[model samples]
Target: MYEQKTKETDQSVMEFIEDIENIKKREDAYKLVDIFTETTGYPAKMWGPSIIGFGAYHYKYASGHEGDAPLVGFSPRKAKISLYFATGETERDKLLQDLGKHTSGKGCVYINKVADINVEVLKQLIDQSVTFLKETYPSE
Candidate 1:
């Protein structure tokens, strides 16, 4: 069973993307949704309330920690877009080399706007993240 609750609204994803209070951020998220879906072949789903999640996977760690996380997800935060890749940093090297204008947090990638970075490289990063998760967590 899923614990996170997505809000109930008739608003379509496009509408929600356009209706974000921050115009620049809204546009960036929309563009990302489009590119992410196209690049990964996983359509965007509004996870929990705000995260734009792509695909999905199941995970269990050596410490017996386990759960299901979206294969690749991002949230358009007020300050920046938070890209979620449950995979840790060591596996994220070469892509990081090409990722521009972004900051990394533990397992999260924070970028100001897709416009400020190389969109193609960003797609590759996301794809790589998804692939890493799938390979690491093959049970899903």
Candidate 2:
């Protein structure tokens, strides 16, 4: 049996953002709060300790691993802000191509700050991720 580490918490998203040691990172986190909230039409929730997540979906794999996860989220980390989005969407790669100066992992886009990317493209990425997840894993 396996337990997931990143479950949603009753913790405060604002407190977490305010606790960010770097002023710029904290400010960027606030900006992201607005963007994600506006894009998803869902209020932000604290996921685990650091991730500010918007809208959630439940998922179960073929192997029976199952959990609820945010449709989109972001963490203002020490090194760079991590933007979480769906990894396998067909339009993801094309959108990332125009997302400005950022590097991406399999499931996260790393940006030094919000100013480094085109906000419109970022919104498009958020929209695509949410749409993909909803269609792929509709609520029960």
Candidate 3:
């Protein structure tokens, strides 16, 4: 009966962006919204308190853990902007090489600013994440 803490919320995405203290991060958040929306053909939705997500899919692992998560998303945190994408795709590493200044974790890509990364590569990551998630976990 474990519940997910980061489930989608009804919060307003703009209101969340507007609350960002950093003017540059706020602006970058807006730009990311536009890019993710255009690439995924899905409206931005507030995931949890901070994540702005596009589209969603439900996933159940072999261990029986299951949850619904955004196909593509990002968060403008105090340290850096974190981009969320599928973790297992090999092509992700290939694209990240072409993506300008960024560090990556197991499933999150961190960039100081939008200008620090190539926007086209960001779009490709978004599309690839959405495609991978949809194909991996098609809804019944």
Off by over 4 Å in 1: 1-12, 89-91
lDDT of 3 by residue, 1-140 (tens): 97998999999999999999999999999999999999999999999999999999999999999999999999999999999999988799999999999999999999999998999999999889898889999999
Give lDDT for model 2. 0.94
Tens-digit lDDT track of model 2 for 1-140: 88888889999998898899999989999999999999999999998888889999999999999999999999999999999999879999999999999998999999999998999999999999999999999998
* Candidate 3 stretches greater than 4 Å from native: none
Ranked candidates, highest TM-score first: 3, 2, 1
Give the TM-score comparing model 1 with the true structure, all chains together.
Answer: 0.82
- Native-to-model Cα distance after best TM-score fit, residue 14 in candidate 2, in Å: 0.5
TM-score (all chains, Cα) for each model: 0.82, 0.98, 0.98
Following a full C-alpha superposition, what root-mean-square deviation does model 1 have from the true structure? 3.3
Compute the lDDT for candidate 1. 0.76
Question: Could you tell me the TM-score of candidate 3?
Answer: 0.98
lDDT winner, 1 or 2: 2
Candidate 1, backbone clash total: 0
Root-mean-square deviation of Cα positions for candidate 2 versus the true structure, in angstroms:
0.6
Q: Is candidate 2 or candidate 3 better by lDDT?
A: 3
Global lDDT scores for all candidate models: 0.76, 0.94, 0.94
